[model samples]
Target: MPGVVWIALAIVVTIALVLGLGASRLRTLSRRVGSFSCNARASGQDAWTAGIAQYAVGRIEWWRCWSLSPRPARTWYREQLELVGREPFDDDGPGHYLVRCRYEGLDFELDLAAGDYFGLASWLEAAPPGRRDLVL
Candidate 1:
């Protein structure tokens, strides 16, 4: 009985440590420049995931909030994204919109606030000259 109790306590402690590390990593990522709260879903996915997005010179990096790794889970290059659709998303709020886009032949959706949506649009349009034309 005592042995079982000790094992359970150890498991609980390990889980807590992992959670703490993940949260710490998320905080560190959120403090970077151009970071914004964003929700993303892949095409055919039924659920959206919350994460932080940071804009780099020519790409956007998305990092899941509950992950322990520092690397971005997905990277969307500015030149490769094609806007498919944009509509007001009232599920979260009035100013939020669901932006659908295609990258590398795969479609995905991003739920973004008005300000963030505009920022993303501007980023897409500012791609370097001579790249494939992006139909917005």
Candidate 2:
């Protein structure tokens, strides 16, 4: 009977330790690394645009973001563009956009296509409002 109790305690301790490690790693990754700032002046644009940007700030995190750079930022943006029409740019259609979006608060612009942009928006939502407004 004593052996059984010890075994159970050992199992519990092991689980707790694993959970604690996971939580610790989560905390570490959640830390802000000070990237994703943004500024944009497109080819034909005269006005300078800027915003506070935040995204996962590590090498792996960035590559994950890069994977989602284009597509549709949000369902609304995708739908709205569809309603307006892709126009002479129609060939690219909703997925046609190959944009160099300035990551709000990050110095460099991420060049992305519309489909790729969809996943990026979810990441951007981690930021505060108007903090990720890099478009245009």
Candidate 3:
């Protein structure tokens, strides 16, 4: 009975160590994500850059997601009604957002940043060509 107790203690210690390490990592991830922002206007490229960089080198395990999995990310973005008539997140636009860009296998965005939300759509989606208002 004493031998079983010793083995159980060792297993518990190992699990504790692993969880402690991961918890610390989560903290670092949170910090990085908080301070991350970028100006890649086209497709919100800058934000994606920052998001990936932060998601990488963090205490989280979402780094190098492309290396971890060889599939495209599951894209998610908030939809806004264009009263005049248009969809946001214009799939055909020039910007992209960091919806599931970080933290794989789960949804990452919780609170929506007005800038991140509106800006992403503006930067990424292509406007209708005639809307440019240029005189040839």
lDDT of 3 by residue, 4-75 (tens): 999999999998887776666444544664233321122223333122222222121223222223221232
Error of 1 at 56 (Å): 1.6
Q: Residue 101 of model 1: what lDDT?
A: 92
lDDT of 2 at 18: 75
Instruction: Name the Cα RMSD for model 3.
Output: 12.9
Write down the TM-score of every candidate.
0.89, 0.30, 0.34
Across residues 1-136, which tens digit of lDDT does each residue of candidate 2 receive? 9999999999999988877765654444335463332333343454534322334332113312212232212121221111111112233344433344322222223333354445455454444465454233
lDDT of candidate 1 at residue 6, scale 0 to 100: 100
Point out the worst 10-residue segment of candidate 3 by lDDT. Answer: 77-86
Prediction RMSDs, each to the true structure? 1.8, 15.2, 12.9
Which residue pairs collide in model 1, if any?
none
The better candidate by lDDT, 2 or 3, is 2
lDDT of 3 at 75: 26
Global lDDT of each candidate: 0.88, 0.37, 0.35
Candidates 1 and 3, the one with greater TM-score = 1
Candidate 2, residue 4: CA error in Å? 0.3
- Highest-TM-score candidate: 1
lDDT of 1 by residue, 6-115 (tens): 99999999999998898888888889889998899997898999999999878899998877776899999887888889999998979999999999999999999999
**Model 2: residues with Cα > 4 Å off, grouped in runs:** 34-136
